[model samples]
Target: MGEARYSRQIPLIGEEGQERLGRSSVAVVGLGGIGSPLSLLVAAAGVGRIRLVDWDLVELSNLNRQILYTSRDLMRPKPFVAAERISLLNPRVEVEVVHEPLVPGNADSIVEGVDLVLDALDSLEARLALGDACQRAGAPHTYAAVQGLFGLVTLIVPGETPCLRCILPERPREEPAFTVGPVPALVASVSASEAIRILSGRGPSLAGRMLVVDLSSPSFEFIELSGECPHRPPEPPPRPAYFRRGDRLYAFEADPSGWERLERRGWAVVEESDAYVRLSGPGSVAVFYSDGGALLVGSRGEGDFREAVGGDLEDL
Candidate 1:
C-alpha cells in the first residue's frame, strides 16, 4: 500500500529520483492557492521534509482554490491546517509548519536546511524578499504568480539564472488587487509539476526562462531574461525595512535591535518619498511621514511592487 501510493510517479521519476525526492527538502511559503497544492503534491511525491509557512486563517473564500483546506478547516491557521492534512495523506513525509509570515529578517533561517524554495505568496513584497534571500543563500527557488486566468512561473538557480529582481526592478508603491477562482487550481498544478520535474531531473528546467500561461486565451509564452543585466549587491544583514509615502518609496537597512518585531507586525514599505513612507495593511495601503513617521491617510493603485523594483524603473 505504501509503495502503491507513489507507484505511478516512481516509474516516471525512477527509483533513484524517488530516493532523491525522499532525501530532499523544500520550503513552501504561503499555504493558500499556490502553496497549498504545491505542498500537498511535494508530500505526495515523497519529499523527505516539507516546511510550510503562512500566518493566515482559512476563510470561506479560500475553498475555491486552496485545495489543502476543507470546510472543517475554516478559521484555522493555514500552515497548521496544511500540516495536519499532509500528515494524514503521507505519514512518511515530515511536515513542519511555521505559523508566521516570511520576511527579510527571518527568511534565511526559515529557508535554511532546505534543498529548494518555492514562492506561493500573493504579495509582491514577500516574493521579492524570498527571491533576495534565496539568491544570497545560494538556494534554488521557483516563483509562480497568478492573476485572473493568467499565471507565470520562473525558476531561479541562484547566480546562474535571472533573479526575481532582475526581471522586476522597482518595488511598487501600492499592492495589486485581483481575484482568483478555480484558476489557482490549474496554476498550482503547473507550478507543482515544474517543481517535481526539477526535483526528479526529468526534463529541461525553466531556469533562465519565464513560462507565461493565459487560461483565458489558453496560450503559452516563454521569455528569456538577459544574463548581462546587473544585480544589486546582496545585503549582508537582511533588513525588514520597506515603506512608502505618496509617490516615493524607501527600504531601510534593517537595524537588528527592532527588526524582528517589525517583521512580525508585517510593517513593510509599500512606497516612500522624502516626505512620507507607505506601509502595507490588510487589503489596504497606509502612508506615514518619513521623518516623524506619522500616519498618512490615503489610497493608491495595486500591483506587485517587486515587479517594478529591479530591472527598469522606466516602465513603472
Candidate 2:
C-alpha cells in the first residue's frame, strides 16, 4: 500500500495508526444501505481485511440507498459485488465475501476473531445473534440501525461499555424496516468513523453512549447508557452448533418460520404469538421465534431438545 493514498488523513491519525488499520480485520454483516456506504468508506480508508457478508441478491428497490450496486448489478449477490468494488477501491486490501445469512448457527464462525464486527442488519434476530456471538468471543461490535428519518449508532466493547442488548432489548416492530436513502448513509458514516477510530487505537467514542440522530429535528442527542458492563463468558457452549447463555439455549441452526413447521408437524402449541410460539415437546417446552432463535425450557439437554423437535437443528 502506498502512503500517498492516505496522505491527507495521515496527519490526523499518524502513520502508526494507519499501519494499525492495515493490519486490522473487520467483518461487515449485512451489505444493505448502511453496509454499502460503510464498506466503501472503510476500504478507502485502507482497512486491510474486510469480510463482506450478505446473501441477498440486488434488486431494483435496493438501487435507491445501496450505493455499491447499480442497475447493471441487479440480481447479483451482494458479497461478491461488494468484494469486487472494494478490491478496485484498494487493490492491496484483502477482501473476503461470504454469501450467507448471519444467523446464530454461523455467527461464531463469521464474527469470532474479527478485529471488529459492523452491524448494518435490519432484523432483531440477526442483531441478537451477532451481538451474542461477538460478546462470546470478546470481539468489538459496531451497531447502527436506521428508522425512517432517524438513526442510532453505538460501539460495544465487551467489558467497558453498554451493549446492543442495552438499547435493543426487544424487537423493533415497523419504523426501522423502511428508511430514506440518506438516513442509513449518514448512520453508516458515523459507524465507519467509530470503526476507524477503534482500529487506529484511539478507542471508541460512542462506547458509553448511544447517539440518536434525527434528520427531521436536526439534532444529535447522546443518551447515557454507561452503567451497564459485562465481561466475556467464562465458559463456551457445550457444542459447536449451539450458543448457550444462562437458561436460554440457541440451536446452531433454526428456521425463522419454525413455528409454522412445528404447526405442520402437529406439535401441540402451549402459546403462540406473531414473534414466537411456545410448544409442548417431549421433554420440555420450546419457544421458537419467527426470525432465527430457539429457547429450550425445562429440558434435560441438547439430546432431549433435539428429540423433542424430532429433527435436525436446521430443520427446526
**C-alpha RMSD in Å of predicted model 1 compared with the true structure:** 11.1
Runs in model 1 lying further than 4 Å from the true structure: 172-177, 236-316
lDDT per residue for candidate 1 within 1-316, as digits (tens), equals 2278788878788888888788888999988888888888888888889999875567787888788889986644567678878999999998876655566776778778898888898878778878878877888888888877888888888777778888887875654535466566666777777778777666536878988888877898998866754675356364344433344323233222222233355656654444334455444433333233222122322233323222122221
**TM-score of predicted model 2?**
0.73
- For candidate 2, the per-residue lDDT at 151 reads 91
Per-residue lDDT of model 2, residues 1-316, tens digit only: 2379999888988889999999999999999999999999999998899999875657688988999999987645577789889988899889986755666767788986679999998778778888888888888888899877889998888777766776665665744367788899999999999999999898889887889999998889998776765433333333344544333344344666776666666677866655455676554555565555565554366665666566665666
- State, as a TM-score between 0 and 1, how close model 1 is to the true structure: 0.72
Candidate 1: residue 66 Cα off by (Å): 1.1
Taken over the whole model, the C-alpha lDDT of each candidate is 0.68, 0.77
Model 1 worst lDDT window (10 residues): 307-316
